[model samples]
Target chain A: MFRETTVNTALVAILVAVPLVAQAAGEPFIITLATKVAIFAMAGVGLNIALGYGGLVSFGHAAFFGIGGYAAGILASHAQSYTPLMTWPFAIGGTQQMLIIWPVALAASGIAALVIGALSLRTSGVYFIMITLAFAQMVFYFAVSWPAYGGEDGLPIYVRDKFPGLNTLDPLQFFAVAFACFLLAVLVSVVLSRSRFGLALQGARQNVERVRAVGIDPYRLRLVAFVISGMITGLAGALYADLNRFVSPSMLSWQTSGEIMVFVILGGVGRHFGPLAGAALFILLEHELGSVSEYWQFLLGLLLLLVVLFAHGGLIGVLTRRPHRD
Target chain B: MTDPVLEIRKLTKRFGALTVSDGIDFDLRPGEIHALIGPNGAGKSTLIKQICGELHPDAGAILFSGRDLAGEGSVARARRGLARTFQVSSVAPEFTALQNVVLAVQGASGATFRFLRPALGDAALTGPARAFMERVGLSGRENVPASILSHGERRRLELAMALAMEPRVFLLDEPMAGLGPEGSQEMTAILSDLRHEAPILLVEHDMDAVFTLADRISVLVYGRIIATGTVDEIRANAEVQSAYLGDDA
Candidate 1:
């Protein structure tokens, strides 16, 4: 039945979307939405690792995403500059190269995640959320004040970052690439969740005291999951920077962080494809609502409140499984 | 005895002027059924907590296998083969009985971090877990979540979890607290069988079950051991007759 819920949701999405995809085959708007789904899905997948699997309620993952994006953006800019690659210590040059950027993005976000996770995990429940938000704000304000790399104005790439032979400027090709990465992320998540460590992690979330009583440390298991979560989200940030050809402090804002969490909740917390479905619905809602009114955010908030108070389980609840009562 | 599995010397615990476990000394021998009986709030649960490293004694020495165990955490205590079942069942209600037991077995099997491989297929651990469940006559209910099981089944599942750890000593807290007549019978029978494996420290309210099963009885009252001996010694003791066991005696 647990497996059935996952399969059912996946089936419904495929069954429902074939016709729409056919209609929007060559349309630019369709391509944009597809990319949005990919991007948001990647970010949601990252949040799922911590929130869904590890039972951590972090509200500042946008900071990790934004850090990764900044790493990619800054490095690409440095590689093209006339100034030496780096001044102090060993000379370090930036790269427009995807190879170098991916690792940097991952490392930057991973380290940021590590610091934030270590501090936040020290406290439980509401305090963890507040501390993560505070740390993300610190990063956001730093981005705003720093005069380098366009500061609050943001940094823009004259040319999109390169990935070997692929001409990433081709919209379809880029979207396909993002989609492929998203699929890989999902596959990894499935494998990890079913793994033994995954069981222990889930067990810790369900009954931490019992887990400890049987000789498994919940904190250590959660720390590893958090790092992996950050790494995956950071990878998404790099892709996002390339897609927009820009990096801004706004990407790291607390609101952006909340949006990622909202996407997870919409997908259904603790669900496999819940995040993916949630991301699609969230972006679609925003796109459709934006056309109706400039003040669509107010309407969106109202709708979300209704959904939280009523639906609770998000899109996954309506489309797939009931809440786990046990 | 020189090789007693667990030795507690002058253990003390306080909750703001109320000394719950006051300077108590206890020892558990190998493969013995030791029963602790008392009214509510007599520090029975507190004693289990101190042994399992949940609550450290304000001042005492907890010697496991003749090794001084102070400052070791719960997991460490468990790895040293000291395990306990919560007074209120603390099992994963969402997981099947077999799955719950396997988690405990998996925990004791050392590293469970073999990612990218299905852990359910690990015959080494799950097989043993299944066997333990079968022993408790839960073979038919292996696939059902613990939440849906009867009160007795949940208690049995709790025992299976602690058993899967392969501990030398088990600290069972009220294994039959909420069971019906049938549940108490089933749980007591299971407890009887469990005594064959390792030394058990049972905290229970059922006087009939306790007197029937306990090889040695220890009555705890007001954070101190009121008496400790065979059933006859407890029944005959003057103070203990008034303090406890009067109705049954």
Candidate 2:
């Protein structure tokens, strides 16, 4: 049996090594796929903070993901068209720099999460899940109907956003950026899970009454966790849109939320590298199984059912052979 | 003889057809164990809830340290040094015993917002938490997860958490409920020593524990205090005997 840190280190090594090997083999497509895994894993890491650590079970994280995507999409589009995003309100303009766009994306998603979490956290269990789902649906519909940023048709970026000291247009260069973000998100998740706030949040998850009895307001703790979670997922969304050079209402759809959740569940909820493992497995399955049959998702669904029924703690849990701390 | 640290004036709560709390006036003085004893369905639990701000009293003024607690919630009340243990031993089962106490210590310190420093590594939280665990006779079981602990140990863990808060009043609900005879004796010993740290408002079904530790006893029957007196006075009261103590005394 290996320590969890050993397992986590190996998982990170695999994620890094796979992309580097692909770049060496001149398989840029594989590098792109690995980059997608990094971005999606980053989103899963975000959702895990709220859903796993906080026990929030939010099902509307796609709203933050889409907000991040649109922040990049709208900003890059505005920059390309040589138009200001707003003429009034101090003449705000868009930028194509990833450095600038990342902050906008994070702030937008964080604010959205704050508003949604404030209202949604008032309810718990199934109601919390449903309310979050409903909020994400509202965002999806708004993106679909709004005419400003291509509405239902979606918006496209002609060029990928720029990051200083690197050529983001190169597949390996872009993977570096996404991989760095993923590592940072993982770092934040790990640090937060061990902190004082983490203890209270996890305590609130296990027993809200006990947490309140100890003089900590569980609501505020959860709200802060939710916001941080959304911000991380939002950053992933920005990188995701940049990867494909496009943003769409589909990014805000409930399917996206479910997919992000699958990554966490498949890897191991609350496990430090759970999302990364889950996302990697998901992408591998999608790629390998899709090439074999059109009904690849059917196989994925079966695997998910097996994981839920038998594995208990997902892939990491099965590998570690330890029961997850509830 | 001194001022009551907690004073409840005419606290009343009605669940539509039935009144759970019927204008209950209660108080806990400094440095004394005030035991609230009652039969099942006598609203002892309801009174505890109202005092701890879990349930809203229909009408009443709860004064803690001479300030009215009109609309404060459970968290606010707890922060103001009103510590309580549940009858069912509520704890984070996933957390280690030390972590549970550390959480209480952190809550008391009002620094739960610290996001980077690892909680277990910090001597400040773990130091007091470890001492509280030792105080409650859970010294060597610091690293044991709350779920696997024996029922009696969970009870002690809850006590350690309350103690870590450095509370002014201890609202202990049936601290001896599920313990065996030996476990109950140990708990009684621990609780007897605890009163020196802070006054206690004990709700218990175990008559032996109540008689042994209570400085004063208040017998509640059907949401009303039937008797409030010394052990001998309560034993001699005919109304209390028929209403509660009866053959059990």
Candidate 3:
């Protein structure tokens, strides 16, 4: 608890304080960067639910992320053009409201997860990983070929989408929105890690047979976790697309999936604030070292190798200086 | 005898050419310990798996509470008052002993889907879980992670988890495999007392514990039951003596 508390406090302070201080100094670019950190951290938190707690290494999480991005992108696009999303399906219209977009993103991602998880959960280990990756690629290719939403050219949002009472175009206000979401996501993860479902999911990760012997269906539990995990990542994707005012086919790509996994591994899988710590370190390295050299990804890869080989538990493990629990 | 709680009839399993279980018939009545004893590779673990639904029998019927268990998953079997402990000490390594028992308690209590509220603070789960740990002789070490528990303590923890299920029957495999003489004695005493609560279909190689605790002994040799009788009958039988009891008999 001590190690967890320390890491959590540091994460909350850095995530909140850094943005506020940067805003006070009138560094709007830093605020935007901070918002990216929060959004990506939220995405890592989503993966942690499946990978960290449920022990499900779903390599296709970008499908959910892309679906979420597309949910926001298509909705905002339709709203901008004053076109209805569907004429046959009850004349569904689009809106720039964050509240509406979030639920739609969650539903879209959750359903995709349900379908994918139902198939993938039947297989495990490398097979599960490959299946998830294959599904993500299928979505990526579909997004690439679907020309209506710009396909490979990507879709652009004319303006930053609206929240109920905030001017989303303002970087600081948007940071607040993303930061609030980041907090909520972390809160959800924390609560879940200590809840009955969390215990069962974690139990399934440790030993599926034990969970089954105890009368809990591991398949059903993993599927629920997978859906919730996708919904969270989907929400993060929506916020990310809104932040950039664009949604690209690459959002659904395998690289995005890898990056989300990197956030979880780099942060320390299963640690309370592992994703935040990992996301912060990753973004900082990308911004700092990335500008210093053209081949910063090589250094990033080397750092990740070092973390896997020696640190084992990622950034949070290094911070805690002790063996961390799953 | 009246109808047994668990009855297995003609249970058979095979891997292509090799038959691991061959027309096995077994039963356990309430308030009795039915010990299944045999040498290594005699399919004791396979038999347990079939009863617990971890492995499907090629041809057989497992009747629990007089209902056929065909097409039912392990979870369904478990929910219907069937509890099993692994030979390999299979409690969750990441959880504390208390947390492990609480999970078993929650599994039986039907609140497994509840999220948002902190399970760490739930009195409904923790209270009964603590009692189970106490029952299994793990009172003070409840907070220790299962990974750090001693081998003997892990077996006890597994027992605590089984008790938390409030099971109608217990399928215990190798419960005394690694216990020291004192630990074995203590486990024997616990099982002797536990039989009054629910019947146990125990599989073990510890003859001392079995001879002391068993109400009836079934000797399995080469995937086939060679003898089923009282402890005195099994000890006196020449076939059981030659096959499994060996020269010591």
Candidate 4:
């Protein structure tokens, strides 16, 4: 079921890993860069779930991304502050635990997506896009106003956080953890896209009235997918906050949402590895552009506009020129 | 003998100043080829849309197998052993011929949600899809994408998609819309064979093909079924003669 297309795998691998290895040297940078790739890929994978296979153009994933970051940052800050977020029947202090934080981030994002998708699904065409963006903005402003986690100033993770055996301070171990999560997310996407619901989702996108005629409620299926997409994207956000050891209102901004989308479309819309390739290219461009000149953003913008106008299929589409089944 | 598979009574539709369906009534029996023919704007497509639940008639009751279908949507109607192929053949352009058929099969095979099985290239779908394509003369082109298919080939692919549902009744809208004489001949032969197993409501502008294959002809004029009779009776009807046949003459 899972077939990787034959390309210059070694070349792509070296291109991705070597620079990372060099910058990483002995410690932090390697781990941080690997984490960046893994986390961003996870976010891109989330976008692919809705946009690629499902054909939903959600322009507001930063809400989920920021939500994930807040989930980790808030919990860690609570633990650091020596104050329990809440207590059950008795009293319990907050703990910065991945086991707990992951589920919270997932559920929070899922629940938010459920509400957003439920309402957003009502409109089609340009209206649906605007509504989704509006909902994300609403949450973004709410995060900005809330004083919790240092408000606009942001909260710092005093500790690198804890995993079962991996040292939080060691870069490569942390990268490995993020990489495992990225792989799992990819596997989940592969499974879900081929799943029965996934087929209905794709069908619904291609022909909504047709699928409804077949006796399945397309709204319900799409909403669930949207929620799952948000949950996964939110998880990426949590990892991102941990990666930077900082969480702020900037994470929840519209620009962040726009950037994630740019990454997805730049790779190849709906292609499995499209997101990974897109994220890698984006990071490289950012680095190269930044080093080349201060106004590197102008070059990045020029490059992206060219890609969109000339290359309809993005990077993978440019490379393969043929459709490959994920 | 029993209730007809589909029953339409007093179906009516109007658009602003014009009436698209003027109080139409019809019945479709199992294993019958009911030909609905008329010149353009006769509302044949409109009536088909109403029956398939894509349009809501202004006044009417459509009962399929004795169950009311007034409130049902197109997809719901499709699930009730009713299927339709649009005049334009609304298909995913990116999908291959086999994948297109499998998508139809996916809806009917109790597996539309199995996103994990890699159904596109798998034999689970490919085997039956191949057989269906062979049935429709598309066996040789399974690997090709639907967009690149010849017009006749795409028409054949559309039939394969509709038949993949194993529908009780099919609402085919101009299945031979753009075929050449040879292509029309092939389509006519295919329809002749199809009428044996599946009841078909064929809306065709091709008079020769229509007169040859239709078991019963329902002649429409300006949103009205002016006449319904066997081919011999229809050929003799003065109104059908002046309105349609005479024009062709």
lDDT of 3 by residue, B79-177 (tens): 988888899999899789998999999999977898888787899999999998998899999889999999999999998899989899999999998
Candidate numbers, best lDDT first, in rank order:
2, 3, 1, 4
Query: Order of candidates by TM-score, top first?
Result: 2, 3, 1, 4
Q: Write the per-residue lDDT of candidate 3 for residues A1-326, one digit (tens) a residue.
A: 35668778978898888878998998999999999999999999999999999999989999999999999999999999999999894899988989999999999999999999999999999999999999999999999999999999999999989998899999999999999998899899989888999999999999888999999999999999999999999999999999999999999999999999999999898876788888888899999998999789898899899999999678888878788665
lDDT per residue as tens, model 1, A1-326: 24535654563466236435744576655765667678778888899989988889988898999998999889888877745557788888788888788888989999998888887888889998899899999999999999887899998876788877788777666776777778788777888887888888888888999899889888888888888888888888888988888999988999988888888887677776767777777777888888898887787677678667877566666654566421
lDDT tens digits by residue: candidate 1, B1-249: 447888889999999899999888888888788899987889999999988988988998999888989999999998878778989999987777888898999888878776787677778877999998888878889888878898778888888888889888989999888998888888888889887788999898898889888988888999999898987788788888888767557
Candidate 4 lDDT over B51-126, as tens digits, reads 9887899998999888899887776677777878779866656677887787777766755655567776568777
* iRMSD, per candidate, in listed order: 1.6, 0.6, 0.8, 2.7
TM-score for each predicted model, relative to the true structure: 0.95, 0.99, 0.98, 0.93
Comparing 2 with 3 on lDDT, the higher-scoring candidate is 2
Each prediction's DockQ against the real complex: 0.70, 0.92, 0.86, 0.45
Report the Cα lDDT for residue B140, model 3. 99
Question: Model 2, stretches more than 4 Å misplaced?
Answer: none
User: What TM value does model 2 have?
Assistant: 0.99
Ranking the candidates on DockQ from highest down gives 2, 3, 1, 4
In candidate 1, the residue pairs with backbone N, CA or C atoms under 3 Å apart (3 or more residues apart, or in different chains) clash, namely A267-A274
Q: Candidate 2, DockQ to 2 decimals?
A: 0.92
Sort candidate 1 into its docking category: medium
True contacts kept of each: 0.75, 0.94, 0.86, 0.45
